[model samples]
Target: MQRLLRRARIPPVRTAPARTAPARTATVRTATVRTRSAAAGTAPLGLLYERHGEPAAVVQLKNLEVPKLGDCDVHVKMLAAPINPADINMIQGTYPLLSPLPAVGGNEGVGEVQEVGRRVAALKPGDWVIPADSGLGTWRTRGVFPEEMLLKVPSDIPVLCAATLSVNPCTAFRVLADFESLAPGDSVIQNAANSGVGQAVIQIARASGIKTINVVRDRPDLPKLVERLMGLGADHVVTEEMLRKPEMKYIFKSTPRPRLALNCVGGKSTTDMLRHLQPKGTMVTYGGMAKQPVMVPVVSHIPQSAFIFRDVRLRGFWMTQWRREHAQDREGVVAMMDALCQLIRGGQLTAPACTEVPLQDYRTALEASMKPFVSSKQILLL
Candidate 1:
C-alpha cells in the first residue's frame, strides 16, 4: 500500500547544463529559457553534489534551479526513487566507473511527466514513467530528459515496485534467459534468495513452472525470511550450513539436481552452488556481495561425461544492455509492469516492504538502506 508522494509546494530542482555544440551542428529546436528569468524566484532544492566523492563526503541537500529543456525533451516531477547499492557506489566513486563530478545521484525511480517541449509525442503531462539511466539524476524533485528516454508506466501500478522495476526485474529476466537451458519442472538454485533480484527470479521461474532451491546465509530471522520468499513462490529454502552438510545428500535423492545455479554471493556460496549442479549443468554468477572472488575446486571443471564438469560460467548484466538491445525495451518493460500489476491486484505478488523517506532525510535513509537486515527497499519520496 506504499505510494510515492509526487509534487510539493517547492520549486523544481535543476541539473548541470548540457554542453553546447558548434553553430553549424546546432539546431534551434526550441527557444532557450532564460536561466534567471525562467527560474525567477523559483529555487531548486535537492540532494546536490559538488564533486565525485563518497555519499558522506560531498552529498548535501541544497537549493538550486531546474535545468533547461530542449524541443524533444520533457520535465519530470519525481514521485519516488530507491536508494540502491549502485546509487551509493556511484556517489562514492567506488563503482567500476564513476559519473562526472557534481552529478546528482539515483538511477531507479518513478516520476510524473510535468511538461513536454514542442514536437514531443507519445507522452503527455501527468503520465507516470521511469527515466532511462542515461538520464541518471533521479534523486532530485524534478528532471529534464529527451522524451525517448522515458518509459511510461500505468497509473495504477504500485509506486514502490515501479521505482524498483528498471534494474532488479530486468536483471532477473536477463539472468533467467542467459543462464542454463531451463525447462518447466527443471530446477534452479540461487543464494541471496531474499534479495530483490533473487525474489524476482523465484516468481518468474515459478510462473514458468520451473522449481527453485533457494539458499541464504543463516540468520536469527531465517523463519521470517523463508516465509517471505515462499510467499513469493519459492519452492525450498536452506541455509549455507544445511547445503554443505554431508547428510543433506539424501534430500536430493528423489528430486532432480539443479541444472541452473544463480550466484549473487561469491566465495563459499559460489563453491556451494557448483557442488549442487547436475552433470553438464551450468552455474551463472552475476553478483559478488560477499566481496570476494569466487573460489571453485579444480575438479568441478574436469570434463567427465557422467558428472561432466564445466566450470561455472560468469556473466555481468546491467539494464543498460537490455535497453541497448531493444530500443523499445521500454514496451517490454511496460508489459512486465502490467504482469506484476496483475499479480499485485490479484493478491498474488505481495508488495515488497518499503520505507518512505523525504528528500531532506537522504543521509539517514542512505545509512539505513546499507544495513544488513532492512526488509525489502528504502524509497525517497520527492
Candidate 2:
C-alpha cells in the first residue's frame, strides 16, 4: 500500500533558465516600485464591492488606505488568489455565509509577510501565510490582518498550491478522514469527480491505499477528461449515464463494495451512487451542485430502507461550522495545514490546472470562472 502511494507521486520540479534583460527589466522595475510604496506607507489596490449583485456589475478596483497595524497585526503582500465558485455565490448574495457590504471581494489566497507588529511572535517579514478564516478579502495586492487570523505555511510550496490549499483540499481531507474509518483497499464513490474537491479526494484516497469510483457528467471531451483523472490515480472513472446502468453492479466484482459514498450533486446522481453502498455504509453530502433537493419515492426510498434494515447512515459536512467548533484549538488547524503541505512537498499532490490572470484582468477571469464545464481554475496573480 505504501509503495502504491509513492508510485502515484507527481514528477519532480524543474528549474527554468534565466530570462533575457528585456524580460527581466520589467519585473525588476515593478518590484522596486512596490517595495518603495511599502516603505512609504502607500495604500494598496483592492477589488471592492459595495453591494451584493453580479460580480462584474458590483466589483470595482480602488486604491484604499491600508489599515493601521494593531499590536498583534501582520501586513501581507498578496501573491496569488483563485476564483472559486463559493466566491461567486457570496458575491451574488446566495452563499450561506455573507460578509457585510463594502467588503473586499476574496476569501482565499496566499501572501508573503512584509511586516509584523512588535507583539507578533510566530511570524516574521518573509514567512508565507494564508487566512485562518474566510473574509480576509484576499483579492488585493496587500492586507493587514490580526496575527490570530492567519496561518503560516512553508515557503517552498508552489504559489498556486499555497494560494489554493485551504478550501477544496481541506474540504476533501476532512470528509475522507472524519466520516469513514477507511482501511487499505476500502472503496469509496463520488460524483462530480471533475471538480476541484473531487480531484483532491482521488489523489488523497489513493495515497492512503483506498480505491475510488469517480462519476462525472458526460461531455464532448469525455475521453480526454477520463484520461486526465485516471492519470491522477482515479481507480475508475464513469459518466453519470454509466453509473445508472444495470451493468454497474459488475464493478464490485473486481473491488470490494464501497463503504463510503460522497455526494456533491444532489438529485438522481446522488441516488444512483447510493444504490451501490454496502450495508451499514455511510454517505456524506457536502454540496448540492444540481440545485435540487434529494428526494426518494416512498415505496423505494433507499434512505428509509437502508436506515431501517441496513443501518446506513447519512450526514452533512460544512467546513465553516467545523472551523467554528474548533476555533479555540489553533494548534489543530496548524497541524492539518502541515499535513497537506507535506503532501505537496513530497510530490504526492499538485494544484488543479490553473490559468493565471493579472489583477487588472479580473473581469475576464470572473467570466471564465462562470462558464459551463470549465476545468482549469482561474487564478488572479497580484
Name model 2 segments beyond 4 Å from true. 1-42, 296-298, 301-304
lDDT of each: 0.69, 0.80
lDDT of 1 by residue, 90-167 (tens): 677666445555566777888999999998988899999886653367787777778877788777767787788777
Worst 10 residues of 1 by lDDT: 1-10
Question: Best candidate per lDDT, number?
Answer: 2
Q: Give the alpha carbon lDDT tens digit for every residue of 252-324 in model 2.
A: 8887989989999899887777678888898888899999876433345644466566677777776766665
Stretches of candidate 1 off by over 4 Å are 1-42, 300-312, 328-351
Error of 2 at 182 (Å): 0.3
Screening candidate 1 with a backbone cut-off below 3 angstroms (N, C-alpha, C), the clashing residue pairs are: 14-65, 14-66, 44-64
Each model's TM-score, in the order given? 0.82, 0.87
